[model samples]
Target: MKKTINSLKIPVVFLLLVSAFIACDKDYSVIESDVLGDENSDFTTGDSLWSVTAYNKKLDSLQINNLGTTSISATAGNLLGVFNDPSYGLTTASIVSQLVPSTFSPEFDENPVVDSVVLNIPYYNTVVSYDEDNNPEYRLDSLFGDNDTPIKLTIYRSNYFLRDFDPNNPENVSQKYYSNGSSTENSALNGTSVIKFDDHIDNISNPIYSNAAFKPSNLATITTVGDGDDEVATKSGPALRKLLDNDYWKSVIIDKEGDPVLSSQSNFKNYFRGLYFKAEANTNDGSMLLLNIAATAANITMYYTSGADGSRTQETYVMNFSGNILNTFVNDYSIPLYDGDKILGDNELHLKGTEGSMAVVEIFSGKVDCDGDGILDLDAIDCFKQNYRQLDDNGDYVKDPITNRYKLKKLINEAQLVLTELDNLPTGSVEDYHTYDRIYAYDIKGNSTTLDYSIDPTTNTSDPLNSKIISLGQRNDTGVFKIRLTQHLNNILFTDSIAENTPTTIGLVLSNNVNYTDNAEILDSGDTVTTVPRASILSPRGTIIYGSTQNTDPKKRLQLKIFSSEAKD
Candidate 1:
């Protein structure tokens, strides 16, 4: 077989062929050739006098399977919090991170004296407008709360220990914690959580009427923004600075009487454990802060006086939050993908991300019950079976009777899958504006199952490419993620009849969370387990899209374009 170059100039073979149907009125003049079989056909196996044809067509149906297994990521940015969205429902997000050693010296010298402890988090001003240069014109200095809807943010000691891999076997790199509650080492609130919500200047809600709403929290800031000579060299505006209990950390950092455990990062981690941030709405209604937990400026600062009263040398040991990969982020969406009151199956779908819902796609199988007749419709099944054939049922290659091969006037050089965006994104807030970068098709086949395939992200990172896995491109201007099903399509088109590859339906995932966690789900991608790493991008928001149920706009629906080579008739 001769190799061919696709539109991208990559040397590869396309294993996508389809049964012909005369539905659309394509230009009759463009029809250069066609393959027809009659009783006179006697073409054998090895024939060199044949022409190969290539063309394009769309899949008949794309069933969405609601694959609601474990959904979460390995790495992410921003510490999530509590908020009540009137339309979307309640959202609660939090941060679980490892704290490393701040100073290697392990000693507090110069007559150390306690000053204060604070947790600084920053957020953006709710969208006002932009200037000609695209800078935020008017900045409303506020955190995430408004209308004094009290939201109590609490800090607590993490109940679970975070490890890079399995703690039992240091050599085992597989067992690790994930965003979705799967791993055994998941951290929960087992200890007491101290409420850190007491920096209000004045509670004047008595004077202000209930009709008016105002922000009630610390600032999310940039440095250098204060009054006259009192202007400090350091900057602190637009930051959520919560005063942590001075006595608690003082016991751990200073009051320990020069504890040697605090000297080593590993010793301190085991002894002190870590911190967990939880947000409780208190009431069912409140605002949630969109925080950059991974911000270079975000931290927990411990201030101390290293010298005497008037001559004290003010020094600080900062607990950096975003540096370690051991950190785990979580987002809880209170709303279900389907209406709680209604009952629906996998065929009827819903897709969402972040603190939102999800839509699973069904694989191409199963029969239809259109006329309320439950029995599998024979005519419909026969039609589907015929349309999916690569060769005629009699075992003869589908080729021209005269030339002994198939050829065509046209071939599909490129095929792309496109999706439409729903206009239901939240307005005004910059944090809510961005969605996920890449969408993934997860393999759901487990062990004892013949469904074998591979999925590798061929973009963003430096991972090598595997031809067996179909990689979907990220969303473009048309609001759809164009995917390349070249490799997977080849398997379905050319495999032997006895051992046809089991095709797996894929779920749209925000992060590249393609881990073969379930023993049943295995990867025969032919590459090493080391090279096929599971990587993902963080998506803080969700969006609505046209599902297979929608019948309005032709472009908005889910579609698949197959580029195949045909035996010219």
Candidate 2:
């Protein structure tokens, strides 16, 4: 038989062509579309479908999965591929002709992003109303005795039917009455809420005792007024407490103009959006990033926005009193083609500085103008440079020190006065400490000097002339001592008169006197032996020289005694 070389060659050639066709089909799977099947055709792979098409569907699903987990960079070209809605119905399937380069471009997510940065500032003053009868027809009062009538202020999603009031019959709107202890059934209410009560009834009563009655003056609107609701004019819906929780509020300088002046100093301000620190490497180079505080105040705001590549990119941030970012940025916090910088995480600004693990960010160069003129701001004063007190007398950052000193002095003086009064009380009085004469004297130098008048005058050597008591001697523990009067007493010895005709040093002579330990004795020119006092003369003198016995004897058995009424030491 002729060896069939042609037949063998043909078979081999056919096999080679088949193998090439299979290999080409595998490569085409990468770019294959779902167009081959009818709209109702199951996307699920089955043995019945062409192998190439089935293989392509499997590859397509893997690509979709990979895209979901990948995070794109801000500077990267938009690589999201295809605007086909994952939620599209079968009827909306793309036509074969619609496939083109422009149509294949990735769709950017344009959903409105809410700025998480939110602040809740309470209206300074609050209000509430009460009804006495608890019924539709009853007397109402704002002043409910000394007891504080408690009320809850609620924030709501909208102004959905709070309650309708019939002024003619207030009981019709009794549902809106502030919940008090007696009205337990009316407590539940729907709205974001806050609560406060006067420690005692605020006494909003008119003392005139009029017959007129007052109910809650309608539901007080949220406001910043000293005596109003907690609503801000710009904010709608029920007043909420959760929103007020992390808001940074500045002192209202000229409060007369309705709204409270918002905090302008970024150093004192905070954005409390939800976020925290975790150890991570940078996207570009995987370098270690140190998280640290850049300023005293929690001023940073996290700028979160969607990138063109369908991934979120966040810029670590801080802002001043005004919505100005501290660190460098291509522009202000305003999002390009978006509303007030779509904040993420619930319209609440997260305070990264307070959390302590926040990453430190450099202030943007555009925000740091150094000519003493402001940066990126029309006014020379930067947002961070606002004077809270608004006083720039010396142009120094610190408010004037003069007022502080005066304030300190006034406080000290008030404290001293209070302490002085306290000292005068029984618990702290001088008598308690045995310092009766707590006369504190001040001299030219404001130094203190003390005098203890509680002591006897004779023992006190603090200058009796400078002292108050005129007497030199006082009754001592021992018997009294007497000196005979003489002209010399007036000069140097003894005399009854303060002035003497002539000066003389009179000699000392002891006058007859009663001894504390013995019977009385008398001294006379003839009776040196004390004959006058010898029993007979001791008798009551019957002789009446004047109205009674003269008893010329210096002492004739009479004893001298003194009684002191002062409580004994």
Candidate 3:
């Protein structure tokens, strides 16, 4: 049963005072006690049994571009390669990035000749130990799936231009892109008729770079230059450093020096376009990597020599992966059917990342019977008002004469949403762990963080992973997630008017980092689900958990448990 609270008149001055008091940094336990009177002398604490409904919702398309009007790149890392999940099926990640020349249209020495072009994209790694010779041993981080298995990698010259502002919008809004390349809406937004991989300039017949079988290695790279006593060695962490064809760079860049196309950034971008890093599965199970492609170390260097053969000087030109960079995902997963009871909620909740799935949770839904007469008389909100509000001699609500609203008799101390994972499901293979460490909750309508999440005292601004871990809740050893909603619930129950302060639906999704609260636009949803969690776009993982309709074990069902305090009267 469910219920909603009706509009009740409340004192504006009193509500203002309570709002002001809640904004302070004092401890909630002492604050609530002082606001509602002494706990031992006048108040008693107890739990409110409220109904919660939760169901799985699939995400068709999610925004991938981090390009804003003021910010160049808001995302942390770009995902690459393919991974096959036991439950969520296959996912392929690719990158489309715009490149900028280190120096625009500069005069090269007379008769310049291309020597080699080297592309270096650094991997997330850490130095574990140092050898006797002072060489460091490194371990790769941010890699998922099977490291031993190889995946097909291809780099192509992109013909499609990634614009900074939307041409269709009059206000010059920043152009947005989604992860799903198959979406016709996204194709239309790009002003291109072709979809997916067809947007690239190169084909299978002739690509910039192609490797049918490619895998990442953890060993440090050692480059030696010169010979004999003059020889020197440089050791660096593991990275994707490969030499490209010199003929290709000579024809594309060297031959066009001082041309009108290379004069400025606007003209250069249209002439060169960019590079597309496409990933394909070579085997049934492949590897995925989180690449720091926007880092200063990630760039393409063109090594060349200028001047006469007898007096040649070595020169280097660099191109950086910058401007408008975005990630594209090709997901092959069985879309879960939504036939479950909406009021009671579904039996299973599916939570996945990277244009995957999310869950909608509604608390205190529908009407409920307050009295034990076996008849539905009032809704849950009305029941809360009747049971927790002050009563008169005739057992009716004691209304304020000035405001004509029933005053709140109980103060909400804490409200927590508990989600338990399904133990029987296979999370991942023995080689890799696919389950996420944290799940974020936000207001569905506002597409923003809850009051509790915003006011979490333990939030560490410097370290994203450590921020709000206790308040937002991490996946425990038993596979349970607990999220606090104290301030959010208090706002709803203690508000002066029900019309303005009704309970809102909550959204739960897997987060790569809790500190990232920014929302990314959805392509085809037409602003209905306006945005998705930005942190969720960085990960490629999934998990299954119990919803609100677990019949076999009622205790395992999703619940909104609220601890409140009321006057001893």
The TM-score leader among the candidates is: 3
Better of 2 and 3 by lDDT: 3
Per-residue lDDT over 433-493 for candidate 2, one digit per residue giving the tens place of the 0 to 100 score: 2111111111111111111112212222222122222111111122121111111111211
Give per-model TM-scores. Answer: 0.53, 0.12, 0.83
lDDT by residue (tens digit), candidate 1, 328-382: 2233344445321111222222343332334444323234443446775544322
lDDT of 1 at 394: 86
TM-score of 1: 0.53
RMSD of each: 12.5, 53.0, 6.4
Return the clash pairs for model 3, or none. 2-366, 2-367, 3-366, 3-379, 3-380, 9-405
lDDT of 1 at 174: 36
